[model samples]
Target: MSDRALIPLLSAIALTAIIAACLVGSTTMSPGRLLAAMVGAGGAGDAIVLWEIRLPRAIAAFVVGAALGLCGAALQGLLRNPLAEPGVLGVSACASLGATLALFYGAAALSPIAVPVAAISGALAATALLAFAAIHTSSVITLILIGFGLSSFAGALMALLLNLAPNPFTLSDLISWTLGSVANRSFDDILLAAPFMIVGLVFIVLSRRALSALSLGEEAAHGLGVDLPRARGFVILGTGLVTGAAVSIAGAIGFIGIMAPHLVRPLVGYDPARTLAPSAILGGVILVLADIGVRLIPSPAELRLGVVAALIGAPAFVWIAIGRGRTHG
Candidate 1:
């Protein structure tokens, strides 16, 4: 790798290692026992804590983060807008509302698949709306405006549902999920999301060449034999799948979709293909660190991971807007 790429690659690995250490340290298992448990040589409780609890949560974090990263990258590529993200598309909001509605109607408790299925359906619905809007107006600003309107509608619907729900606990649970916390996510959550994540990643990984080709401009990409419709379709489907699955588990953890790709794009010399893996790794690390920070600073109450991300993301967003203003001026 070039020096530029080497640094991010090393940084990604280091962040991963630090996150692994933090996870082990934070849990009941000691460093030595956690190491032993990894090799299947620990006591039953240590093994259970390491394997059953921490391992799944860590894996879930990675998968969820990776999904967000890849989905964001794909959306940006498809939209030809650096600011495009799963969140901006209103897919995350739609999924959040879907999960909330499920909880409100007691469907989530009725079946294990209800939440994921509903969330995915909601994301697809948002994607469909975007597509319909795109047909009418191809402008990026218009697309974003429509997405914002959809998100607002979804958020309002969610609040209404929560208010009308008979059970207060259900409303609270739904609200907490909307705030986005990874605490107590089980192996079942991992299982439910894994297939979607994998399939989504595979599609996105294959689309890297298409993304890079499109960077030359859609007309040029078409002239060079790139199939525009197929490429855009893949991006939309892959992003929807990954983001939907992530929302199903983590409940609309926003900003990582925007942050991860932006953070790594410079290191890759703006190459979307190279940025992909680094973004995924960094996304996982950032969220894990954010989660760790949430636990440490907030103490026993535990901070919401989405809140932490937004705290970081909102400032970065302001900086971006200011930078754009300076450039335009």
Candidate 2:
């Protein structure tokens, strides 16, 4: 199918997955019950389950996945590197690290919003750093390396926190933040993320034309009057916002960003600009399905969504890395 057809089809699939998410929880709502709940006519229990629990979780999962996917597509386009992703910028790690600190310090006991607030702050800090670098530095490699340093430092700090954990419970909580989840989310969480997500999305949208131009080659793009530095700033800032927002909501869900664009690019004939929406849709579907699988697992403690994502995404990441390396070499 063409890009137009493919996008709508992916969107339909995403919708189906989200609906499945709403209907396949522990209570297993029937279509009729789901409809009634949508219209606010279901039983009180059903409404609570669907509206407060399932629907919020499903939407949060979609929003997180879409953010990562859009960031991945735009990053890959900007860098002209297939291996690029939001995590490549270290914003996701920094965000998670912030949340880990909150969990470590017991801020979560004070308020549910504390962890998310910390995570988003961390991500914005990364964005500010990257934005400054984009303005001052001419090389993309410098930005990537700086991100690597940030990620490495953040990972080390997280490890230290894990090691210095005062108790098993604290350790487990810290680890869980890394493992990631959207369980027990509510509309309040979504509302909190909306503004940041919108800002991030706008940055990416504004960078799309520059991304398309850069795909031809930096010199050719410059000839076409693409403001490379400005584009880089927008892409980096956008990526930081969405990535932080995603990690805040879902606690460092991994690989969807890289996986989404890679899977969709072939279908879209590898047009960076055309890849964003389809990648986002596929990313949402992937996460929803992963969460569904998490629900279906027979394990006693319920599989963490990040665990499932890593299980699926890590292999794909390696495979894609290999493919890109060989093609480029």
- Report the number of the highest-lDDT candidate: 2
Lowest-scoring 10 consecutive residues by lDDT in candidate 1?
19-28
Tens digits of per-residue lDDT for model 1, 102-212: 877879889988988888778878876786666567687898888889888998998888778778787779778778877777888989877877787787887888888
lDDT against the true structure, each candidate? 0.76, 0.85
Q: For candidate 2, lDDT tens digit of each residue in 1-329?
A: 69979988988998999999999977789999999989989898898899989999999888888888888898788777776676766778899998888878878789877876788778878767866775577566687788788878888998999999999988887887778898988899888778888998999899888988988987899999999888878887788778877887888777888999998998987889989888988888889899999998889898999899989998998899789769877
Instruction: Count clashing pairs, candidate 1.
Output: 0
Model 2: ten consecutive residues of lowest lDDT: 130-139
lDDT of 2 at 152: 87
| Runs of candidate 2 exceeding 4 Å displacement | 102-117, 124-149, 167-169
